[model samples]
Target: MVTYLLDIMEYADSDQVIEVLGGAVSTRVIRHPNRSFAFEVTLDLEKGSEHFSTKPPLHFHANQDEFIQATEGKIGLELEGTEYILLPGQDEYCIESWANHRSYPLELERQEGRTVVKFLLSGAKSPEVYELNTLFFENWYKYQEHVVRKGGKIDLIQALSTFDAGGTYVSFPRWVPFGRQVSQLIGIVVGRWLGGLLGYQPFYREWSTDWQLACDKMESSIFQRRWAVRSKPD
Candidate 1:
């Protein structure tokens, strides 16, 4: 299985991309096939280091509070620079528009790896996110290293523009005709690679299972359901 580092700079504002405090985090946003809604979550992997940084001045969702949890591994909540170790199975909350809060992995040597997911509820859909994501990744394959340095940062500014205005459903345009199909396949391919590299034997085998479940739950507009699970990060 291949694990792509969550290069949010590909689809988000680079300056807005917060480094997950303590673990390797991969974030993916899956949009609903028939609606203006989208579900985004980050899978936090256990790391050798104990420090991470948050993107300050987060104002993405002024109307909603984000629901977050450490589904797997160890993490310490960083609220305005103070650290609070969050036990496995514990849940946390944050208001993105209000508090400048973020999380990092705990510093303990014996702490197990962890996975954290965030449910963002927003009505504004950014059409440029789809455009830039498709274009950036497409160019990435052809130009590879050159694309990253040359024009990668442009994607985020465009995404922010599409999402700048407030609305009930963030309107991300479905520019690629086969977007749903492609995203599913990417999920499967990425999941498999990640599992193999991280030794999630059983977990790797179930990547498709989790992707399907996440897709199904997305249809119902419920991001918190147990069925909407992603792979467990080690």
Candidate 2:
């Protein structure tokens, strides 16, 4: 594997775009030199054709807290045991630390055009949250192509294991008996040993050429988009 020296100062652009769940996601650092304080991420999705209604797995951030604002369209969020639908221009929905939450688009069939929503994340231990996000997306992006072509599935155990290393725990769905404990144990073992053997690095390595390539791709796309918007007729 080739390695490249990456500048820490330029890790992510304030307007960098990255691919996620077959959608375009743009992330910006809200706080200054210290990103641990807070950061913002926005997802843009097309109506009808894009499947944005599927919710993420039920999970909790042990340290980080998140607030979501919908700029356009509506978003559904499950915080703790209650559900909420945030409309455009409404107040931000806050999810405190340790609260189990899941987010998804609301009423996709009724929505038209495009949808955009932003998330502001912050907490005392927010750095770990950011690291976990980076690791999860890196692994997902790396294997997305292969998984699609082979009609294969993502290894949930492996993903849980990798996230465990960054202090994010994946809770088992209620259907499985004693799944929480069992999955935790398996995650710890695989994350430490098997994941290492397979060369899964949970943390960002600036020296990895893969990291450099991913950053370059995102930045280039953002630059091109900005140039196009500027050159368009008013």
Residue 203 displacement (Å), model 2: 4.9
lDDT per residue, candidate 2, 1-234, as tens digits? 211111122444443344444554554534334333344556666522333445667776555565566655667788765888766656656677656677776654544654565554333335342233443444544454346547787666456544654445565666778655665566556764465455444433431224443333223332212211222222
Q: Rate the local accuracy (lDDT) of all candidates.
A: 0.33, 0.50
Off by over 4 Å in 1: 1-60, 106-110, 113-234
Global lDDT of model 2: 0.50
How large an RMSD does model 1 have? 17.5
Shift of residue 229 alpha carbon in model 1, Å: 34
lDDT (tens digit, per residue) of candidate 1 on 1-234:
322112111243432222232334433444433223333434343342321333222222323343344444555555544566554344344434323345454443535322343333212223321212212212222232233336453233222322221211121224755543443334333322332243322111122223443334222322123333454444
Clashing pairs in 2: none
